[model samples]
Target chain A: MAEGKFTQETVSMTDAQKKAQRSRNIIIALVLAAFVVLLYFGTQAKLGANILQRPL
Target chain B: MSVEAIETKSDDVLISSAMPGDYYRLMKPRVMYLVIFTAFVGMLLAPANINPLLGFIAILCISIGAGASGSLNMWYDADIDAVMDRTAKRPVPTGAVTPDQALSFGIILSVFSVITLGLMVNWLSAFLLAFTIFFYAVIYTMWLKRSTPQNIVIGGAAGAFPPMIGWAAMTGSVTIESIVLFAIIFLWTPPHFWALALFRLKDYENASVPMLPNVAGERSTRNQILGYAVLLALSGILPAVLGFASIYYGVFSAALGARFLWLSFKVWKNGSENEHYGFEKKLFGFSIFYLFAIFAALGTEAVIMRVIG
Candidate 1:
């Protein structure tokens, strides 16, 4: 059966695969952080200089 | 086949492992390309200047949301997909990805796309994106697709939403101009898909999907295709009529619309078996070019105006 093709071992990562996976995870995290920072600044720019200033 | 049967099959001891690329394929990248292109054009056409970074983020989120819908569709339709030759090799059907995994991936991406767009862009566009995903995945894929002959006609609206979302990204609300963009795509869809249905009638029949050709007779579908083509031609010129686009664009859109209608007429006239001269096949191929060309013309017009002014 097609299901039998995917044994637990097939899904399990080897040591090299595990190391590569960790590296990819780290890269994804860093990229996500950069996106957040970019979005924050972009929103601020669009909102203008007194974006955070409140009405008295 | 029921969802339960598919899930039960997926719950086997040895689930098929998927590569990263297999997961990517689940998102239907080809369809996503059209969505991204339309949305990008809408963003460009908007009156306001969007910050480049936010604009990129908006497009990224929209693409992800589109991908999420594609994944969910694959998950739900795995049973029929397995049966259809065209889809038998898809990730879920081929055992490259389990239905459960695809479901989780789709759900996660859907939530992520909506939340990120809402936080980074305006809420209105985000809401539209969320609704597009739901409409495609639930309304179209789960319900209308199997139940109705007008599935493409109705469900086509989901595909038509991206440009509006892009316009909303800039303006924070939809406008008549954006709706014109929506209408263009909405009208273009039936003829395009019906042409394809003419050629792939057997695939739909095997899947038991109530496609227009399968439910209504072929002759009726052909007549409907011609009818939609005529309407599409009229709607295609709206941007010029509405004054957002120049006369040059209007002329060009009208020319493309004319050719589209001609192709539809050709498809309706000759239902012959000749492979190379087959009108249905030609129409199907031209329909793709028709949509791309129309959108590209609009984007080009926008660019020229920006440059000259």
Candidate 2:
């Protein structure tokens, strides 16, 4: 269908758009890092010194 | 058909202009955040011992599933979304993402999230996650949204399922605790959405979305909101009553419940078709906080108890 054909066109990103994309990637990376940090602390709190124990 | 012919034939040319940012927007990141938080609370409140890495993976899958549902909803609702001022600028409507692209993106993500969750975590939660997507995309977005005034009332079950899914991710089965969490969200959504509908009645009217205020009249909507708020307040206290949360949580949630009810009453008494004050908006905003704070209290207490006990 022409509708599907319409969606296949490639887009050229502008410099500003590239910058915005980079910023979004950075924010996503930061959020992932925060999640890892929270997970580490939570595991530590829950497991105490046994945090590194293997899965049962 | 020539490319030139295609370009000149329609004013609304469906171009593929979607950047990564537009893809992110397609996920409805704000709603995704709320889903993540509530699901995280479900993870915390469960009695099973989940490994840290697996828990993280489960939460990630849940987030992706939520995102998938949002994208699918946007894809299906693009018609009305283009017409309604509130949603006119959404990625699909604005042509940042074509409908086909959005639909493909959603389907792929939904399948990926479900399979990944099932393989990495447990199958029960994955099943719940898949059902949530189907319910939201098909039942709510495709059917209930345009057909019924009680759309959000029944469709709220989709949102309320995340916590239960998270709980299942941990325990591999649902429990009373998770059901209580589900009930709280399910009860809260009617008032939360109806209040927003009160303020944005024109938008719904224009979209022909059958939101409560547009269908039931403001008085009936407000009365229903008050009624739901009462049930929400009671549901908010069940964790403490069932012996999972602390008395402090009981007291805090009860107070929040009372405030929520009072605001609902204010909205009911003062809500008008012509006069647009901040009362309904205030209730809408507080409704967000009320959910977040209630879940936060529950999760924090559970975490502290895990550390201390």
Candidate 3:
């Protein structure tokens, strides 16, 4: 009978890859912020100026 | 004694190596620019006035929708894109973004743009935007492109819908004027694309994509290009003919159309036998300018009329 040896491999992202990932994260954050702003203004425009004047 | 070793899974090492710019490239910015310009013109030419904020929202939605279609196109066509010189460097083809990532991005943007448009603006425009995305992503990219010579001819409708969608965004309905704008783009597509196909016949052949010049032969494609050019030239003046634009615009369009016809004729007569297909290349370049010039003239005329009256 022969005994087998097991080996484990470890991997890490390069600096370039890390920078790219960080840039993508920043862009995603900016886009989400922009989308929120768009929604706020869109709601205001859709509701119009008399939005707050509704009867309780 | 026993020792334990820790290993990182391959997929877990780097979630994604794609840059933000790579994702932007996947969206085909040039094509999105054209869609945005045409849709903006449509909004301006519309009979009813749109609120400025709403109009900006509409254009943003339409542009994002166009970009989403482009991303989906790159995802589905990545294989052929890798073979074609023109598309070889696209994000998916170059491996900057994986196909699954591109697909997810496209689907997410498509849903977001459509839902936002419906919620912020009107449902009709939203529906048109959704349909346009489907037509481009599924009909044009997934089906027609791999199958037939008439791919662009029919697929052109997907591109033509932006202006109609814009008009609907403003007016909440489709009208003859919008249809005329659609027809202008529809008629212009075959010649514009066929001219490119003539120059890049080998690329289509290598990719097994049946472009007109590849399947129909150069002579037939050239003639068809000339035919479409003639139709496009006539359609270019339709807005003026229909009283939507000034007679001065009609004259300007006529001059541009004549140049288009002359270039098409040159391509037809000379054939693609030339080394560079110079005539075809010239016509292709001119066709882009012709569409832009015609749309710019119409949009400018509308603005002037609104200002004066």
User: Number of the top candidate by DockQ?
Assistant: 3
Task: Choose 2 or 3, whichever is better by TM-score.
Answer: 3
Comparing 1 and 3 on DockQ, the stronger one: 3
Using alpha carbons, what is the TM-score of model 1?
A: 0.87
- Winner by lDDT between candidate 3 and candidate 2: 3
Give candidate 3 regions above 4 Å deviation.
Answer: A1-11, A53-56, B1-14
lDDT by residue for model 3 (A1-56), tens: 01112344424456777788799889999999999998998888887987688897
| Candidate 1 docking class | acceptable
Question: How accurate locally is residue B27 in candidate 1, as Cα lDDT from 0 to 100?
Answer: 100
Of the two candidates 1 and 2, the one with more favorable TM-score, higher being better, is: 1
Clash counts per candidate, in order, are 0, 0, 0
Which residue pairs does candidate 3 place in steric collision? none
For each prediction, how big is the interface RMSD? 7.6, 8.7, 10.7
Alpha-carbon shift of residue A24 in model 3 (angstroms): 1.2
TM-score of chain B of 1: 0.94
Per-prediction share of native contacts kept:
0.20, 0.05, 0.45
> Ranking under TM-score, best-scoring first?
3, 1, 2
For residues B1-309, what per-residue lDDT tens digits would candidate 2 score against the true structure? Answer: 666665565445433435677888899999899899999999998998887878887898899999999999999999999988889999988877778878998998899889878876889999999999999999999999999999999999999998999999999998899999999999999999999998898999988899988887989998999999999999999999999999999999999999999999899888584486488999999999999999999999999998998
Candidate 2 off by > 4 Å: A1-56, B1-15
lDDT of 1 at A32: 77
Local error of candidate 2 at B284, Å?
A: 0.8
- Tell me each candidate's RMSD, in Å, in order: 5.2, 6.1, 4.8
